[model samples]
Target: MDYQTLIVAVDGKVATVTLNRPDVRNAFNETTIAEITQVFRELGQNADVRTIVLAANGPAFCAGADLNWMKKMAGYTHEENRADAAQLAEMLHTIYTCPKPVVAKVQGDCYAGGMGLVAACDIAVAVEATNFCLSEVKLGLIPATISPYVILATGENAARRYFLTAERFSAQEAHRTGFVHQVVAADALDATVADIVKALVANSPNAVKEAKRLVQDVAGQPLTAELIADTAERIADIRSSEEGKEGVRSFLEKRKPNWLN
Candidate 1:
């Protein structure tokens, strides 16, 4: 599909959705938000796609809201403003809940709303020199919509500091806070991301998809009979699945799984 603000490509089973608006540092305008939501929804339902990598071009992964878009929002009434914000919130949610494991290949600095993009991914690998900031508070605004994912990524304590201080932190700091999984030199970024992608693609697609859903459904839930029963049922259902049976047969027979072939 053609997109005015994105470059989408699929190689084998991996689909990459690159933010192409480098002229504006890939900032989020209404159009960018809409395209991201649309593309992710399509990719999530694509059986040929086993994993997705969210990437961006130029010097910044994303610079948050476009200056022009923000200017337009400045005059919107409360209802209009709420509606506009909802688009962004839903876009982030779509990425967070995508069935495929989305790995963020953050090759540059990320800021403001960009934080939401990184946080929504299942994994993030960033360049060592990249800087991250949550500067909404500096503009007399709050990171309201992105709060859920950001908090889950960086923990409540880290969010309290960055969300309030609006400080620009280094990639190491982001990794330390668990916001990014790995931080590598610029030259090593692509190799690192490719390695991660390769590993993801090698796994059983059904298992990988179910694992993602498992995490979402199990996290933060109280440990009780209901929760235990639910988890037991999930494992049982998967174990009885064709893919699961083949996985066991392949392992016992010393061969690659059918999916890999």
Candidate 2:
């Protein structure tokens, strides 16, 4: 699918969705939101695509809402604002729940709504030179739409500070706060993302998807007997499946798995 705001490409099992609006720092308008939602939905269902890389062009990863879009929002009624916010919420949810593991290649600065884009991904790799901020408060707005993701990426304590302060933080601070997984030099960004993609591609596709779902389903849930039984059942079910059988047999035989072949 063609996108006015994105560049999508597939090479082997890896699919890349790049934010293409570099001129405006790849900021999201309503159109950008819609296209992002559509692409992640499509890529999630594409059997040929195993891992996805969320990338951007230009010097900044994403600078939040497009200036023009925000200007348009200024005239909107409360109801219209709520509806507009819902679209952005849905867009983030799509990427967060997507079955394919997504790697955020944050090459430069990410702020406001842009931070949500990174937080929604399974893993985020940013350059050491990048700066990040949750500057919504400065604009007389709050990071309500992206709060769930941002809070999860950066703990509640960190969120309280950043959400209110709107202070610009360095890549190191983001890493220390556990927001981004890896922080490396600018030139090492591609190689770092590639290594992660290679790791994901080598894993069992069925298991990988199940693992992703497992975390989503089990995280923060109570340790009840029902939950324990559910997990046991999941492993039992997989162990008897064709892919599971092949995985074990190949390992036992000291050979590459069928999925690799």
Candidate 3:
């Protein structure tokens, strides 16, 4: 599908979905949110796309909701506002639950709902100059929709501080908080992201996708006998699967797996 707010490109096994509204600091509106959801949904189903990189083409990665969009919302009724927020929530969920791994390539400022985008990714690499903020409170709004992913990425303690303060934090702080996996110089951003994509694509696509699902499925769940049994069953299932058997056989033979070829 065509998109006005995003630039989607694929190279080999990696697909890059870039927020293209640099003029508005890539801040999202309803249209932008809907487009992002649709694009990711498509890419997630494409067998050729092993991974997705969330990126932006602006000095600011994203500044959250657009001013005009917010202005339009100010006049919305309570039910209308709920419907609008639901779309944003679904969009974030789509990225968070995508079967393929997602890596955020953050080069500059990321804020509010933008923070949601970064938090939803499976991995993130940010430039040293990048700044992140959950500034919704400052605007008399809450980071409600993005909270599920943001809280998971940033942790409850850090979320309490940042969510309440609405203060800007550095990329280093983001890395420290575990939201960003890697922090690199601006010039090295592309290389760093490429390196991660390389590692992801080299792995069995099915296993990588299953691994991602495993994490999401098990995280925050209490350890129980049923859970333990479920995990055992899952491992057994994968071990007997075609890809799993081939992976082990190739490793034993000291040859590249079919996926690598």
Candidate 4:
């Protein structure tokens, strides 16, 4: 599908979705949000695409909502605003729950709603100098739509401080808060992200996808009998599957697995 705000390119087993509105620092308007939701959903089901990289083409990774879009929203009634917010929520959900692994390549400033995109990715890597902020409170607005994923990325304590303060934090701070998985120097950012993508692609495609879903499914759940049984059932299902048998057989036979071959 064609996109006006994104550049989608597939290279072998990996697909890169770069936010392309550099003129606006890749900010999200309704068009951009809709396109993001549609493209991610498409890539999730594309058998040829095993992993996805979410990147941007500007000085800022994303600057949240576009100014013109904000101007339009300023005139929206309460119900209209809820409808608009729901779109943004769904866009974030698409990325968070995508069947394929998503690695966010955050190369610059990630502010407000942009941080939501970062939080939704399965793995996030940022440059050492990259900045992040949840600056909605400053505008008398709240980061409500992105809160679920953001809260999951950064725990409640970190969220409480950042949400209320709306302060700008460094890449290191983001890593410390567990929002970003890795932070590297600007020069090393691409290499670091590439290595992660390589590792992701090397794993069993089904296992990788299932592992991601497992974490999303089991996280924050109390360790009850039902939870334990569910986990056991999941393991049993995968262990008896075609990929599982091949994985074990390949290791014992000292040969590359069919996936690797």
Candidate 5:
């Protein structure tokens, strides 16, 4: 699909979605958010796309909301503001629950709503020099929409401090706080993301999809006997299925799996 604020490229099994507004550090406006929501839906339906990598074409991955856009919205009525915020919230949810695995390739500073984008990804890799901040408080605004995803990525304790302070943190700190998955040299960002994509692509698509579902299915749920029995039954069914049988046979024969071969 053609886009004005973003670019989409498909190569083999990987789809790369690039934020294209480099002049403003790829800051998101309403159009950009709308495009992202539509693009993710498109890629989710594409059979050839097994994984998606979100990156940007500038010094920073994203600087979050467009200040000018926010300024304009300051005069909007309560109802109008609700509608506008809902658009962004829905877009973030689209990426968060995307069927295909979403990976973030962050190169530089990510602030405010940009951090929500990172949190929405299933996995994220950041350059060593990359910095992160949840700076809405600095502008006398709150990160209302991104709160759920950010809290999921970073626990309440970390969020409490960072959200209030809006202080910039290092890539390592971001990883420690559970925002970033890995940190590598800026020059090696591509290689690192490629390696991760390779690893993800080597898994059974069905299994990966099921596992992603499992994470959400079991989250915050009690481990009851019925739940355990249900899980066991599900695994037993998969073990007797074609993909599972092939996986076992390939392992026993000391050969590469179907996904790799």
Candidate 6:
């Protein structure tokens, strides 16, 4: 689909969604947010797309909400503000729960909602020089909508400090806080993401999808009887499926997996 603020490209089994608004550092407005939501929803339903990459053009990955958009919203009524905020919230949620693995390629400054986008991705690779901040509170506003995704990415303790302080953190610190999966030099950013994409593409799409769901199902759960029983049932079902049989057969035959081959 054609978009003014973003670009969507599909190559083989990987689909890339790039934030194309660089003049304002890719800061999101209502139109951009809605475009992203619609594109992600489409990608999620496309069977040919096995994985997705979220990247942006320009020196800054994103600067959060557009200043002009914020200015326009300043005079909006409470009801109007709520509706607008809900749109942004739904966009974030759609990306977070997308079935296919989503990867973020962050090469520059990522602040506010930009940081939230990285947090929502399944994997994120950032440049070593990249800077991150949760600067919502500085403007007398809060990162309320992105809080759930950010808190899940970074723990409660880290979120409490950064959300309140609005301080800039380095790429290493972001990795430590669980936001970035890897950090590479600026020159190596593209290759790093490519390597990760290769690894992802090498895995079975169905297995990866199932694994993602399994992680979600077990997260925050104890090793209770019910949990164990649930997991056992899931495993049993998979083991009885065609994919599982092929996986075992390929392993014993010392040949490349069908998906990778």
| Per-residue lDDT over 1-261 for candidate 3, one digit per residue giving the tens place of the 0 to 100 score | 679999999998889999999999999999899999999999999999999999999799999999999999999999999999999999999999899999999988999999999999999999999889999989888999999999999999999999999999999999999999999999999999999999999999999989999999899999999999999999999999999999999999999999887
> Model 2 scores what on Cα lDDT?
0.96
> What range of 10 consecutive residues in model 4 has the weakest lDDT sum?
252-261
**Alpha-carbon lDDT, every model:** 0.95, 0.96, 0.94, 0.96, 0.91, 0.91
> What digit string (tens of lDDT, one per residue) describes model 6 on residues 111-192?
9999888888899999999999999889998999999889888889999999999999999998998888898999999998
* TM-score for each of the candidates: 0.99, 0.98, 0.98, 0.99, 0.94, 0.96
Residue pairs clashing, model 6: none
Q: How far is 149's C-alpha from truth in model 5 (Å)?
A: 1.1
In the range 1-261, model 5's lDDT, one tens digit per residue, is: 579999999999999999999999999999999999999998988878889999999899999999899888999999999999999999999998888899999998999999999999999999999989999999988999999999888888899999999999999998898888999999999999999999888887777777777776777689999889978987997888777888899999998778765
TM-score attained by model 2: 0.98
TM-score of 1: 0.99
Which prediction has more favorable TM-score, 1 or 6?
1
lDDT of 1: 0.95
Candidate 3 ranges with C-alpha deviation above 4 Å: none
Which residue segments of model 1 deviate by more than 4 Å?
none
Candidate 3, 64: how far from true, in Å?
A: 0.3
Q: Which pairs clash inside model 2?
A: none
Residue 178, model 5, lDDT: 87
lDDT measured at residue 92 in model 1 versus the true structure, 0 to 100:
96
- Measured by TM-score, how close is model 5 to the native structure? 0.94
What is candidate 4's CA lDDT for residue 62?
98
- Model 2 Cα lDDT, one tens digit per residue, 89-159: 99999999999999999999999999999999999999999999999999999999999999989899999
RMSD of each: 0.7, 0.9, 0.8, 0.7, 1.6, 1.3
lDDT per residue, candidate 1, 58-100, as tens digits? Answer: 9999999999999999999999999999999999999999999
Writing each residue's lDDT as its tens digit, candidate 4 over 4-98 gives: 99999999999999999999999999999999999999999998888999999988999999999999999999999999999999999999999
